[model samples]
Target: MRRESETCTYWSELIAYLYGELSADERSEFERHLLACAICREELSGFERTRAFVRTWKARAEEAAVGLPAISLGSAPNQPQWRQALAALREFFALSPAWLRVTSAVATLVVCALAALAVAHAELRVSSEGVAFRTGIFKRPPAQTKAASSEPLYTQEEMERIVAERIAAARAQMLDRIQSEQLATREQAQSMPHPSPAQASAQQPDFEHRVRRSEQAAVALARDDDAPRLSDLLSEISD
Candidate 1:
């Protein structure tokens, strides 16, 4: 009953049906259509024939009988306690330089990891007790700087300039939309050849409202237009 996108082709459904995994209702419907649809019927028949052929070959395959040999397990050579200790020492000295380096690196890494875990545990305890880790050996992130503060990434002025540009773009867009709406309202009023008494009275309020709105918008735009340029301010500060 799910509505599907027309753009999504039915290849996935066809694959499911080919695997004999379609729901009974869907399968029955598909089969009923297959009786009249030659292409689907032929494809289904071909798949069925391939499956039968594969099963036939499987049935004829002779399974190889495996015989495991009686494996004689070897025992370790018995050595005296002193000889065993000496052999161990010999083996340690026989290790290649590469293996020695690998062992040393692994040991160093494990020691470092354990030290980090211990330090982190102590730091977490301090944090849980409301004590800042930054006061001692650990350090916290730097405090937030002022918006007007200088940074290596960008001068305070540059960031301000970008923000100002964005704000100006948004204001311009909003102004355009308001103007277009006002123009549409004027067109609508002019299109009407005549107005009734009640309609004329209604028009008066709308006209007054529009005039007030226009004046407010004009004032807002004028102020925004004369606002200090962010880029210029930054340039002056940089100098």
Candidate 2:
């Protein structure tokens, strides 16, 4: 039992010894100990058996690995080569400098924006008036400056008829404007407070009497002026 306990205590050393990983002196000492102890001898034999089993397992695993092709976890077997290339490119870019990546992204965005603007700026319009250009970057085209022809497109009689029609339309518009103004004036007058009938009558009489008094005064002043009268002429002729 004591020998058994001692052998158990050297369990880690026994594993190292089975792998031949110990120093020469330590291996020799352990071998001498094994010779003197039956329990140690049995334990070393068990370790040797376990090492043989592990070697057999490792050999079998290597053979199996050799028979099968290597499969990468990063890429699928059936995926296209372009996808793999793109993935490699992405990885390269990811490993590139931060400034370079940012500059490329910004340059791409700016180019796209400028291209959109340019496309929008290339518009042209045609109409009966003339050709016109519409753009976001350039100024608007000037209005058509060509003067109308002096000669009328229509005959004289037709021109007169058109002129008459325009005059009639203008007259109608003027009449409509006058009527609207009169109606607005009438509405304003109706909105105002008016004097009572008796107050209006009283005011009229007073105003008429004042007018008559002013007329009589004007006649007296005219008679007193230095103009010859008909009675004076007759008296002068008799004298």
Candidate 3:
């Protein structure tokens, strides 16, 4: 009965013994038991066989890892040409310098921004009033006080000068508006109360306590009432 119990106990540790994981005294005791026990010796042999099989599998995995280039060369049949090309392109991009990637991203964003601005600035309308040309960024197209005539009244140079003047004036107005808004924001920020050092130190723990209290309150409310969940309230608001 004792030998049966020991066998049962040490059955789980057979692999550990086979792999030399047992301490020196434990291993010595197990070895002495092995000499007397046929069942333990058979179990140890089975564990040794399993270990040898795992080592063989590991050696094959290492060989496969080392032979990946050859495998890829021979197995081009599995993947489509476009998929392979895309994978190659992805690998190339992955290896690109950080600065190059950043510059590419910035250039793409700038192009998109410029394109959006150009679309916004362009105005094309065909109505009973007649077609008009309006492409200025900030200023409205000049109104025609005089009736439209086939003959050109203003020379190209005069038109260019007028457009330039309008652009300059519009730019100045925009700059003034921006500066005023910035000044107002700065003044408002300055007027706002700032916490003292003592208040600042106390605020962190107070803020955390308030958050915990709010969470507890919410949980209590949820448990007390069969009211709609917070998610449902949010979804209703969104709708």
Candidate 4:
């Protein structure tokens, strides 16, 4: 009986008592209370386990869909591939994960549509002017949803943070590439120490010629910078 009480209090009410987020007292209470309540203890254990399973379900779903490049939304007659896929997903030979995404996407679409229908349904019950103030789905410039223009914007700090994160990632990648190239260069220099003794004597004379060529190329680049269109550089170079 003591063991069962300990599990119950910990299991069933512990999560919900989190009250969306747990209060200090609620948290303290749950921690202490679970020790005595077996049912709640089991419920909490089950809930945590269930949450982990749900997380795995999503990860698995993403993996299955990863290789599926976005299907052509081209003038292909079937534009509602999502809807069709949603309907037919269960039959696909793909693993259970893809099916889960299809199910989730379908449910999300349905919920959005139903919510829209409900709003429109309510609005229609009371006959108002032709222009409903609802969010417009049309991009036709004349058909404006002016309310959207008034929507609250993200703060400047949020935008800066996002940009900073991107810049940091790029900098990190640049550093890695620089380090890798530097390592490769050191290794190459070490491996050939002085090239082969026979080739070293033959190639030593060509070093000055290559240096002169590189200097000429630099002068040519400086000259072209003033005259060349970007498109000229992109012209296909046939080997």
Identify the leading candidate in terms of TM-score: 1
The stretch of ten residues in a row with the least summed lDDT in candidate 1 is: 1-10
How many Å off is the CA of 109 in candidate 2? 56
Cα distance off (Å), candidate 3, residue 72:
24
CA RMSD of each candidate after superposition: 37.0, 28.7, 43.8, 36.5
Model 3 stretches with alpha carbons more than 4 Å out: 1-9, 68-239
lDDT of 2 by residue, 175-220 (tens): 5665565566557656856779987676667556655655565565
Checking candidate 1 for backbone clashes, the offending pairs are none
Candidate 1: TM-score?
0.32
Taking the tens digit of each residue's C-alpha lDDT, what string does model 4 give over 1-239?
A: 12344334244445466345777777788778777765666555655544444444444456567864444323223434444444334323122234556898899999998798675543333355555545435424676545656543654455556656765576567556655655665575458768788988886666645555555655654564477443333332211
Candidate 4 stretches greater than 4 Å from native:
1-13, 17-20, 68-239
Question: Number of backbone collisions per candidate, in order?
Answer: 0, 0, 0, 26
Q: Which stretches of candidate 2 lie over 4 Å from their true place?
A: 1-3, 6-12, 68-239
How high is the lDDT of residue 25 in model 2?
Answer: 97
Q: What value does the lDDT take at residue 66 in candidate 4?
A: 89
Worst 10 residues of 4 by lDDT: 230-239
Candidate 1 lDDT by residue in tens digits, 1-239: 01231223443455478798999998887777666766555545655544544433333332212344323223222444345445544443332234565787799999997787676654434555586532234657689976874537876756777878887898889888778877877888789868889889978897879867976886788788788876667777777
Per-residue error (Å), model 4, residue 59 = 0.6
What pairs collide in candidate 2?
Answer: none
